[model samples]
Target: MGEACERPGSTEDCVDDAVCATDASETGDPADPVWETYTCRAVCVDESDCPEGQECRGVTGAFATRACQPLR
Candidate 1:
């Protein structure tokens, strides 16, 4: 549930029930996919919707996606 949406190329909008978020690190040469910073996390309703050892939690940023993240 960490992939992007249904588009042909870059600059895609999140599909229904998904949100765009960033989690990037510096690359020696940043040019396109060499250093991608955006991710699509699934919006979960509760723990039941998550896999084992994970729980539905709000995404790190101000986004509305509630992804199933591993316990802290």
Candidate 2:
């Protein structure tokens, strides 16, 4: 569910229950500058909908789309 994708891309680019959402996690290497990547992630309504260590997060404004995100 972590496949890289283009911004504002189509949902067809992801799996059946996933969307091309922004990966909110930190970079693999701390030495690297913070960069944003669009990845395929499962949609969720709340923390209960995500995996054990993830949560459903959105920007909390108009047009904000929620997706499963890692808590760490």
Candidate 3:
């Protein structure tokens, strides 16, 4: 299984595309939200793929995973 980087500051060094966004859960479960790893993933760029109130965004300036997150 891929390493889980749920924390904000956590970053994957040396990765070619190590950018990820947070996928928030409604239940507020303790388990971390799934981190979608990607290489120029569509969900990262296409806001249309994101659920309501969430938008596709990058993480840590890296391009590892693109995930859905609430507007900031």
- Scored by CA lDDT, what does every candidate get? 0.56, 0.67, 0.46
Per-prediction TM-score, please? Answer: 0.46, 0.66, 0.37
Cα misplacement distance, residue 28 of candidate 1 (Å): 18
**Clashing residue pairs found in predicted model 3:** 17-63, 17-64, 18-63, 18-64, 19-62, 19-63, 19-64, 19-65, 20-65
In model 1, how large is the Cα lDDT of residue 61? 53
Local distance difference test, candidate 3: 0.46
Give the alpha carbon lDDT tens digit for every residue of 1-72 in model 1: 466533312224665666554443465544442424666655678999877887777765544457665554
Stretches of model 3 off by over 4 angstroms after superposition: 1-43
| Clashes per candidate, residues 3 or more apart or on different chains | 0, 0, 9
List candidate 1 stretches off by more than 4 Å: 4-12, 22-37, 63-65
Candidate 3 at 39: error in angstroms? 19
- Please give the lDDT score at residue 41 for candidate 1: 56
lDDT of 2 by residue, 1-72 (tens): 789867533467788877776654375665553547777878778888888988888622215667787764
lDDT by residue for model 3 (1-72), tens: 123444442344223433333444445444755444422222345688766876677654545556555675
